[model samples]
Target: MEPPSTCPPDLDGPTIDIVVADPGWHRLIPNAGTIVRRAAHAAGMEGTIVLSSNRVVRGLNGRHRGKNKPTNVLTYEHPAPEIILALGVVRAEAAAQGRRPAHHLAHLVVHGALHLNGEDHDHPGDARRMEMAESRILHRIGVPNPWKRA
Candidate 1:
């Protein structure tokens, strides 16, 4: 099902819809929607963000990407812009990297939003360009550069 509604007008950017399929996401990061919305706005993207579990994400990944693993974030820009994030994978990645879940979530949203905005990292040059864009967007929201993580 879709979310209750998209982000409010105060953000002053693209419209971002947020769906919290897994309520437990709050336990991992209470302001997941806010973080996502802010990141999406920073990237100047309008889309839907689904906060779901590894099980849900794995199913989608298998059907869509032919991969049978739970990924952190997936972006679809065909019919419309949409981003899905798996709570389990995101939390684990954050812990493994010694970073806050909130920061990681923001970074992922920006990354996915960039994808929706036609950014790809398939080549070295493209990767650098996308990384730089992600860094700038994240910095605007006060998130550190994920690439510079120790």
Candidate 2:
């Protein structure tokens, strides 16, 4: 169940490069690059996505965000705009939140792309707007509302 190397033909949007460093999680997410590309197109952004392990994400968090913990996703703008996803954190969070891994991954990709597009959730209003946009994009992709209570 290796992830697809290329995006779907219909997804004619921004280019995305998905580098999966964790082989175990690779089977869990098929067509991950397509998902990220769709989200980026929906959010009107162009970037890359790195699908990695929790350890890598944790290290990045400690160095960049100063949080010193693994997060589901992180978006960075320097060197090159890109989104880094921690598969372990994403799987755990999705299970806890009762979301399918694919759906949860879609949500995170959309969230990261939004951040790359300058959408921030640091404030209540901004958060609301970003969430709404995420919902809309997810809906368009046929994924259920990730924020909806299970």
Candidate 2 at residue 75, lDDT?
92
TM-scores for the candidates: 0.91, 0.87
| Residues forming the 10-long window of minimal summed lDDT in candidate 1 | 1-10
What ranges in model 2 sit over 4 Å off? Answer: 1-11
Q: Among these predicted structures, which one has the highest TM-score? A: 1
> How much is 45 displaced in model 1, in angstroms?
0.7
Report the backbone clash tally of model 1.
0
What's the count of clashing pairs in each model shown?
0, 0
Flag clash pairs in model 2. none
TM-score for candidate 2: 0.87
Q: Cα RMSD for candidate 2?
A: 3.1
Candidate 2 lDDT tens digits, 50-145 = 888899999999998899999999999888888888988999998988788988998998899888888999999999998999999889888898
